[model samples]
Target: MLTITATLRCQGGHEDVLRDALLDVARHVAAHEPDTIGFFVSQDLADPCIFTTYERFADQAAMDRHNTSAALARCFATISPILDGDVVLLTGTELSAKT
Candidate 1:
């Protein structure tokens, strides 16, 4: 499996917008991307504007497909203007067993 974790810091007061946009992205991925095993979005309690995305894909190709997806592009465009900086993406192996 391919796992991607992204930390995004939104500009102050833009947290709600970012959260909504991320929810849309998650819905789109779940509906259209067959290889997407899971996609989750969460906000940090210490920094409400800081959002994190945990994504799991079937393989590298699945991840690649997500990068090129229109939904992802739209999500980026929607959130770019309100972001404090570039999203921090961390790619790693999934070591935990799945239920």
Candidate 2:
């Protein structure tokens, strides 16, 4: 399995808008991608514009497919301007799980 965690900081006053857009992307992936194990978008309670997305895929190929999906491309295009900085992507390994 492969896990990806993305942390995004939204421009001041654009938190809600960015959060909504992320939610839409999450729904689209969940409904259309069979290899997606989990997709979650969340907001930091103390820092309003900070958002995080946790995703799990079956493997590296699945993650690559997700990156090439139309839904994600569209979402990135739409949310680019609202971002405060570059999105931070963190990869993780499940210590007990096999790829």
Candidate 3:
């Protein structure tokens, strides 16, 4: 299994817009990508500007396909301008899981 975690900080006054865009992306993934096992999005309690996305895929190929998806491109276009800084990505192979 492959896991990808990303952190994005929205520019001032753009938190709601970014959150909506991310939700759209999540919906797209759920509707189009069966290989995507999980997609989770959450906002920071203390800092509304900070958002995190946790994505799990069946394998590297699944992740790669997701990266090249039109849905992801749409998401990038929507979030790029409102982003405060470069996105932070963390990736790894799942070692163990209970779920």
Ranking by lDDT: 3, 1, 2
Worst 10 residues of 3 by lDDT: 90-99
lDDT (10s digit) by residue, model 2, range 24-48: 8888887898898888898999999
Local accuracy of candidate 3 as per-residue lDDT tens digits, 5-30: 99999988999999998999899989
lDDT of each: 0.93, 0.87, 0.93
Better of 1 and 3 by TM-score: 3
**What TM-score, over all chains together, does every model reach?**
0.94, 0.91, 0.95
Per-residue lDDT tens digits of candidate 1, residues 46-72?
999999999999999999999899999
RMSD each, Å:
1.0, 2.6, 0.9
